[model samples]
Target: MSTPTSDVHATSPAAEYLAFTLGQEEYGIDIQKVSEIRSYETPTRIANAPEFVKGVVNLRGIIVPIVDMRIKFKLGTPSYDQFTVVIILNIGHRVVGMVVDRVSDVTTLLPEQIKPAPEIGSAMNTDHIVGLGTLDERMLILVDIDKLMSSAEMGLIDAVAA
Candidate 1:
């Protein structure tokens, strides 16, 4: 006979995240959400769109909206350079692109390696933050890309579809 606690432990599997940098902080998103990575390019400006929502770019036949994570998180002034890249993500049925400083590498984290995000009150929204991943001396702010992209305030997914 097996214990319930042991069964729960057995079911918890390791998850892989695509690590990237936004300003000085390192962020990680679920690997499955990543569609592809492309070098930064100037996107056609959309009038009335939020500043963080840089604009849209034609990806093949699809028009993908690009969101600058730096601006969205209020990290600092964003700069475009050789290291800049767009991480195309497949969230829900919509495709979105996220601009990041640079991509680090894919990291696999076990359940034990992830720490719960602290409850810091309503001043900041932590709903999209999965947890903090610790590996060696590196710490990654794991983000729930799907939730962040689909949030009501973003108005991205629905607007793009329509």
Candidate 2:
């Protein structure tokens, strides 16, 4: 005699995500957009650039623009420490970088695990929020880095010429 099986596999397709944190919230992005992860480095400051645009870093021979997600999201004050990391992403023909508090890990989440973000009246923008992902007891705010980084508000359209 065998006990009834409760273990069942999710029917939804699985995709890997790069999980990161900003303040008290956790976020995830499609791993395919990520090219590399580098330690924090003070980039060359660009004059007249927005606050969220930290500056630009010469990655190899390529000049990459770095954006601070915390500042972009208006998440109060942002502090950079040893744990800070920069995720290099390749969107279309443009390569950009984003600064986050710290990267947790690469997680594989099934489609069923992701839920559409609820619309709520808040000062924070949710346009870039892909959805909310539920994994065990943790919830991740999945971000559409492509859309967010390439948006006109980011002023990356001009920078893409680089």
By TM-score, the best candidate is: 1
The local lDDT score (0 to 100) that residue 160 gets in candidate 2 is 37
Q: How much is 10 displaced in model 2, in angstroms?
A: 8.0
How far off is model 2, as Cα RMSD? 5.4
User: Model 2 segments beyond 4 Å from truth?
Assistant: 1-12, 156-162
Candidate 1 local lDDT, 66-140, one digit each (tens): 899999999999999999999999988788899999999999998888998989999999999999999999999
The best candidate by lDDT is: 1
Count of backbone clashes, every candidate in sequence: 0, 0
lDDT of candidate 1 vs native? 0.89
lDDT of each residue in 1-162, candidate 2, tens digit only:
433321233444688999999999999999999999999999888777788888889899988888898998999888999999999999888788999999999999987788889997686678888999999999999999877987675565345324
TM-score, per-candidate, Cα-based: 0.92, 0.88
lDDT of 2 at 102: 99
Pairs with steric clashes in candidate 1: none
Q: What is the lDDT, from 0 to 100, of the residue 19 in candidate 1?
A: 96
